[model samples]
Target: MSLPIVIIGSGFAAYQLVKTLRRQDTQQAITVITASCGDDYAKPDLSHVFTKGQSANDLIKMSADEFAKTYDITLLRRSRVESIDARQKTLRCNGESIAYQQLILATGAKALVPPFQGDAMGRIITLNGLEDYAASEVELKKAQSVLVIGAGLIGTEIAMDLASADKRVILTDRAEALLPSLLPDFVSAQLYQSLGNQGVSIELGTQVESLRQAEESIAISLENGHDYRVDAVVCAVGLRPNIRLAAEAGLKTNRGIVVDRQLRTSDPHIFALGDCAEIDGNVLAFLQPILMSANALAKTLLGQASNVALPPMMVKVKTPRLPMQLSGNTANADANWQVSASREGMTAKAFDEEQQLIGFVVTGSHMKQGFSLLRELPPTF
Candidate 1:
């Protein structure tokens, strides 16, 4: 029998590759090594579960057993891939050596644990996967008020979801505004105000200096000399790619596991994708790019040479209070943004010196207009 194509990690990247590969060639022997229960769930839904009326279990599209049975894959749940032996084409997992024809690293990113002086640091939680969410669900349900650190995309979205679920949410960041790196001031102001309208308190321009246990609640001290006591704390700072295994294997790595356009790593037999993989110097962690990479890699694995080619995909900010979608550099844009606002929504377009649309942002009811704007925007990947 031929050696199976073994994939490390069972996140969206790995599962998507299996799905894409099976769509064309179902008979290929595939094996998945996952750290968790191997339940297939959308990571993006982690923040929106409250607002979307979903529990952690509800987020799972399929269980590991079901998925493996459906796709004819050898699913190893609750398993970890400790080391990769590129030269020998083997993996040291659970004190066992497993061989593979081709290996793919889909080990996703992990939540960034913010550095702070805190005795109660253990009380703060960071959600990055189904397991994290499942573990935090009980604490979230018991808490009335929550302190959410960071005001970036994930932070802001989780804050809104918490607020919408009737939890008193304090959204804070070291930056002056929410998503300061992703939106213009005017647009951010709109979102800031909208979040306020949704009953979320915004504390910007400062980070948590310390966190202390206050009886049953958590005491949070901000660098701005402000303090608050909340029933729970969630740190939604950001994510750092998982590159330790790949790096230990002697594969090239920078911000993430460096791979070529073909999703091939330094070792020709090893490939990578999703949050852990950086292609062409870009670490694309978004769903669209991950799916594209999976499709391209699927073709490549099937002996069809293909490169990851991404379209201008706009990301929808899941804040129901003031919906928004954007692509390209809205913040620090090379050109000035042509701004327009109204009762329906606001739309900002940025044009280069050549007078071509390079980037854009839309909010409120102007989401439908994003189609045309996205078409005009320059290639991002």
Candidate 2:
């Protein structure tokens, strides 16, 4: 009997790897352990639930039993992994010792909740998974107004969704413009104007100072000397990779669990991918890189010795009013942005010192050019 290959998550990375591996080789014992109910859902849909009219239940693409039967693999749902004994090649999950030939960590990421003063901290919510989305749905039903902290991708999307649903939305961020890390000033300015036109109160260059419970609402104080009362607060600041388990298991970790080109961790028998993995010092929390890593890791696990090579990937910001797409130079460093604005929309191109196109942003009618612009940018890795 062969020992099973164990996967420690059931997200996109874990399932994608399993799907990729099973396509090449059948009859390889595979076991998946997940802390959740093991439902297959598109995580990107979580932010657009309001605008799409999707409930939390609608987000689930596949149930645990369905996934298990479809893939012919063992699914352990709602089981928390206690610890991993690397030397013994065993995992202690829910007090059960399970041995494995290989281990893959796809634990994903967690929402970063910054500490703030106030007794109504419980009213602050962060959406990182299905459970968070479900909770947000419940909260939204009871609230007429929402205060969103952070004007990044998730925050802006949620604000748009809520505003579209006739809810009052106030989107606040410490940065001067929206998507400051991903878009050029001109592109972000377009989105800022678009959101404001949609009745979203934009509060840039400000941070939440505190939250206090008011009569049937939460009162939020900002560092910019502004105070507002809202039914709920959603924190979309960012995500921190879930690396505690890997670090506890004695695996090397930085922003995420350290991995190589093949997605192998410090321990050869252990591997990692998705939001939990930092490959060659790059933590790609996007779907494209995760899929790329999954393919390479699947081949490597099957003795193919594959290495992941990713091209420049485009990030589509799902703001219906603005409809922007950005590719490359998300850091906005060491590049000059040359922007052209018109009634149709705005196109901003980022060029390096060599006068080569390194990144680009397309908004509104010009968003159709996003693919062509992506081709001009250099490969990410």
Candidate 3:
């Protein structure tokens, strides 16, 4: 009997890959091993679940049993892959050895928790997966005020969500502006003001120095000499790709698990995608790139060589108080920002030295312009 194809995750990438692969080969033996409950849920919804009044149980899109039965695959929930024997084509999970013809590492990433002097580090919650969100819900129920660390995409969205839920939210970050890596100064400033107006206290250019247990709350001291006492804390600093298992097995790794255009790792039989993969030197840790990579990798596994070509994908910020859509390559450090703002909204376009539109940010009614700019921008790959 041939060994089954093993996938080490149950996130969007893993499940979507299985669905795509089954379309080509209906009878292929496939097995998925996940550390979590194996329930299917849109991870992005974790940030705004409070505003939607949805619990972790309500976020499940599909049960593990249903998903496995639909795809004709095996689902191993609450299982951790301890190690990988690359040469033997086997994985050790929970003291059991499982053989695989080909292995897919969709392990995804972990929420990055910044180090600080703190005895109350355990009190800080991070919303990364279903389990984390469940834990955070419990914490929120007992707290009236929340402190959020980081002003990036996830951090900002979480702040907005909490503020909308009527929780006193104080959001702080080390960066000078929100989403410093993704948005221009002017655009970020606009969002900063918008969030502030929505009753979220914005603290830019600040870093948490220490956290200590107060009388009934957590006392947080900032590097900027400001201090606050909050009932709960949520950390949304960022995510670091899960590459330990692959690296331990001698797989090449950089910012993430290194893979070729075909999503194959150093070992030809092993492939990676989603937040865990750095494909062709690009670590696109987002939904669109995951879908595109899964589609292309599915074809490759079915004996057809295919490469993922990602077009300029826009990111929709879920802050209803300040609706925003960002698209194209805004990471070009050499690009210049041409911004125009008014009472209606703000449109910030990025242009390279050659005067070509490389990226744009649109808020309010001007979001309609995103589609046109996206068409003009070049493919990300």
Candidate 4:
């Protein structure tokens, strides 16, 4: 009898892992459990729905039942795991204990919302998962204005979505510009202007101090002695790895559940991937890295002792208002860079001491060089 495989979490990693594994062995029994509704959708697409003229419902790629039927695997939608016993190879859910031969965790990350002063209770949302998106859609209907707490990729995308829906949007960040996590300073300037031109007021270098409730709305106060009254607030600060379960199960963990190049956790019977797993000491929160990790993990499950060697994975922002792609790590100390910028666009390339290209950033019109530049970069661990 083939051993039953159990997979936790239903995100890009989980879906792709199942697809890739089934392609190699169709008869293996597999089960997927998720806490949220199991309609598979691209997670990034959640923020840019309005720009693409797509509805929240339209974003669902496959229903849970359909996915299970299509892949010949069991799909447990809206099911939550309470505990995992790694020694016994058992998982507890809703008072039921299930045994598995091997376990895979695709438990993705959660939005990080810093603690701030506010009414003890108010309408605040985080754009982390599908449920969050559905809640945001409902909040937008009743909102006349919105206060966004972070101006990173997700925050900027959410602000732009709200603005396009004709709601007054105010985007604030502790950093001095949008795309601070991914784009360089010169590149950010163009994005700042582009968003500003579209009526999205950016309040960089500021933090949300508190939220005051009004009779019919809310007023958002910043630490810099500024106040703006708005209808609702959305927090998109950043993401934290979902590692509590793996940690509690006695698996080795650092910033995330530590995994090797083959995506296997400390326990050979257990594996971890996606935003929740730290591979080669790197927690990649981007799509390309996630895809590459899934493919490599699947190959290992198919009886190959393979290590996933990642090329410099590029980060692409779908802010159609300002499309940009960045490849490789920009924080390399051993590399010198040459930057080219304009009011419209910018490009920067980091070259090693030996004159080999190591990393790059592309913004606006220079985004066309993304592929060529990444092709020249050295492989990232």
* lDDT of all predictions: 0.89, 0.89, 0.90, 0.83
TM-score of each: 0.98, 0.97, 0.96, 0.94
For lDDT, candidate 3 versus 4, the one ahead is 3
**Regions of candidate 1 where Cα sits further than 4 Å from its true position:** none
Clash-forming residue pairs, model 1: none
In model 2, which runs have C-alpha deviations exceeding 4 angstroms? 330-334
lDDT of 4 by residue, 28-125 (tens): 89989899888788888877765565667888899888889999998888899999999999999878998898899999999887887878235678
Cα lDDT of model 2 by residue, 268-323, tens digit = 99999899999888889999889988998888888889999999998989988888
Worst 10 residues of 3 by lDDT: 328-337
- Ordered by lDDT, highest first, the candidates read 3, 1, 2, 4
Model 3 lDDT per residue over 89-115, tens place = 999998999999989999999999988
lDDT of 1: 0.89
Residue 365 error, candidate 1, Å: 1.7
What candidate 4 gets wrong by more than 4 Å, as runs, is: 331-336, 340-345, 352-354
Residue pairs clashing in model 3 are none
Error of 2 at 246 (Å): 1.0
> Which candidate, 2 or 3, would have the higher lDDT against the true structure?
3
Say what the RMSD of model 3 is: 1.4
- Candidate 3 wrongly placed segments (more than 4 Å): 331-334, 340-342
Judge candidate 1 at residue 24 and give its lDDT: 87
